[model samples]
Target: MILFGRLRMLLLRTIAYLVDSFILFILVIAGFQCFLLILGLHPFIGRHLYSITGNELHLWLFFSVTIPVYMYYVTMFNTRAQATLGMRAVRLQIQTPGRMGLGKAMLRASVMLIPWEATHVAMCYPKPIWIDNQLQSPLFYTALGLTALYWLLPLLNLNEKSAHDWITGTNVIQWQVPTSKKP
Candidate 1:
């Protein structure tokens, strides 16, 4: 019964994360479009798109998307609400041993993204992992395994804590709304 409840929580968390990611995707696209508009290059995207070199694209992606996403997690975790927009929607909040500060929130956010970074590194290698319908790169396999383990950590533990939560000493729990009595 306890295991089933934990699994349900995991599913809710996953749903919340997907919602957050979708929101971020839309926001990023809208922001980029506005940027191009401000630069007077919105109408020239088809022609000027190829002018952005691979390194430049990487830098833009890291600065414009990755950093903001990381900061979003940190900021939300440290807020009075103690939850991201999606987390709030799902009635979930981050609970810490102490009042979560900037440093702790940042650490939690960074640890959460490690698996993604590992996968990015694996894909950026010279040789592709998928060759002739088979995955041939050790690095890619390691990254894939780590990503699975990272998400599956909650299922392996009684506390229902993921790897990032354990590393940062935080937990995701159902949020309780305070009720006030009218005088």
Candidate 2:
């Protein structure tokens, strides 16, 4: 019975994650399209865009919007019962490993967003080069590798133990609606 329950919870969580990812993906794409449109409309705005180069403006746009959304979703949902959308859809809740608070959620989001995602991007580049004589590629690649490991922590729970849950001292629980007693 316990194993069954855990499996069900895992399935539900996976579905929720997929749904959330899809939504965020669409949002991020739309945001970038909008940014491009704006840049086309006002070329001057593009001149001030912060990027390694004008060619990389889209990367900056993606990071700017997606990171904040990711942080908000994880921090809000992981720390609280309802994530921005997933928990509410499934009627699920997140509980801290040791206690209830937003600190772990925030920390998790910060680590995943900045280091993990950035690392993945870095890995895409070939032949590192110094930017302003600074070695930035190595740092990003290292961060990417570590973040990938951290993200996989949840997968460890496939056998019923989550590294993420262990690290944050957190657990996701299924909420059962109470049946009314006979009057």
Candidate 3:
């Protein structure tokens, strides 16, 4: 029963994450398209659209997607809702004994992004992983281990708390909306 309950929470959390990711993905793509459209509208600058490359493109992605996603999580977690749009949709919220302040929220958000950033860094390596017939980068393995640990922590713990929650001393609980019956 306990295992089943934990699994259910895991499923909910996964769904919430997917929902939030979809929201961000759409926003990022739309923003990128809008930028392209604006450039296309300018006769002089339109010709230079194809010139965006290398570090410039990377910088755009970092600013447009990474920063916004991090800020979104940090702000939402610290807000009165104590949940992202996805978390709220699934009736889940993060809580701590005391109010979750900005510093703690930022910490939690940063920890949550570790696996993603690690994986990206590993993939961005100039050399292939099988160089010299050996696993060239340990970073890929580290990222995989982190991803597995983050997913499995909730199941292993009685409280169903993930790595971020444990590190930040926070809890992701199924929120129950209080109902007021009119007398």
Candidate 4:
């Protein structure tokens, strides 16, 4: 099987992330449209998405969709197909030394969510809807700061492994597929 070099791996992974992010963006929009429409609050969300951001129901819906949506794409896809749609398109697969189990696949996916969740929280820190007080604690900033390191983890290694990889003992690699070429 052909293995992807560092540059190739990083490029494919970045493309996969962009594709997957677009997919999530579409899903979030559709979900919000349907949910608000059902609640008959469509008028409230007529032009501004910000209208719903502070709504408790909207927050609930967002979290509900966010966790399962991401976990499904990351964990279920990795567990079942060994790759997500974007990763499949790029011919990248998640590999482990032994038979990859559901738990480990799930852990790998969850670990990858650290930066995403942290960034979300950091952005919302000023908003008092989630809590009465602004979340400006040192611990909060520290967690967000760690995400910076998490993102840079891949740069430190030649194999292009990330913090999530080191945490879960999983590797993202190129998957070999037969290509047809006519002579």
Ten contiguous residues minimizing lDDT sum, candidate 2: 126-135
Task: Report lDDT (CA) for all predictions.
Answer: 0.78, 0.56, 0.79, 0.67
TM-score result, candidate 4: 0.69
Winner on lDDT (2 vs 3)? 3
Which whole-number lDDT from 0 to 100 does residue 149 have in model 1? 95
lDDT of 1: 0.78
Q: What ranges in model 2 sit over 4 Å off?
A: 1-4, 39-62, 78-82, 97-100, 111-119, 127-161, 176-183
Model 1, position 3: C-alpha lDDT score? 86
Question: Model 3: C-alpha RMSD to truth?
Answer: 4.8
Residue pair clashes in candidate 1: none
Model 4 global lDDT (CA atoms, 0 to 1): 0.67
Candidate 1 off by > 4 Å: 37-57, 127-135, 181-183
lDDT of 3 by residue, 67-176 (tens): 88899899999998789999999999997887899999999999998887766556544332323222455877888899999999999989899989989999999985
lDDT by residue for model 1 (1-183), tens: 988998899998998899889888777767765777789875435655545444454455567677878988899889987899999989999987668999999999999988776665565453322322225667678889998998788888998999889888889999978799899
Q: After TM-score superposition, what is the CA distance of residue 51 in candidate 1 from its true location, in Å?
A: 9.8
Which residue segments of model 3 deviate by more than 4 Å? Answer: 33-60, 127-136, 179-183
Per model, how many backbone clashes are there?
Answer: 0, 3, 0, 0
Candidate 4 C-alpha lDDT tens digits along 1-183: 123456567778889878877776676657656777789775545554444443444355446555766666656545655777778888888777766777777777777776676555554444423443445655467667887786666666876788878887777888856589999
The C-alpha RMSD in Å for every predicted model, in order, reads 4.0, 6.2, 4.8, 5.7
Candidate order (lDDT):
3, 1, 4, 2
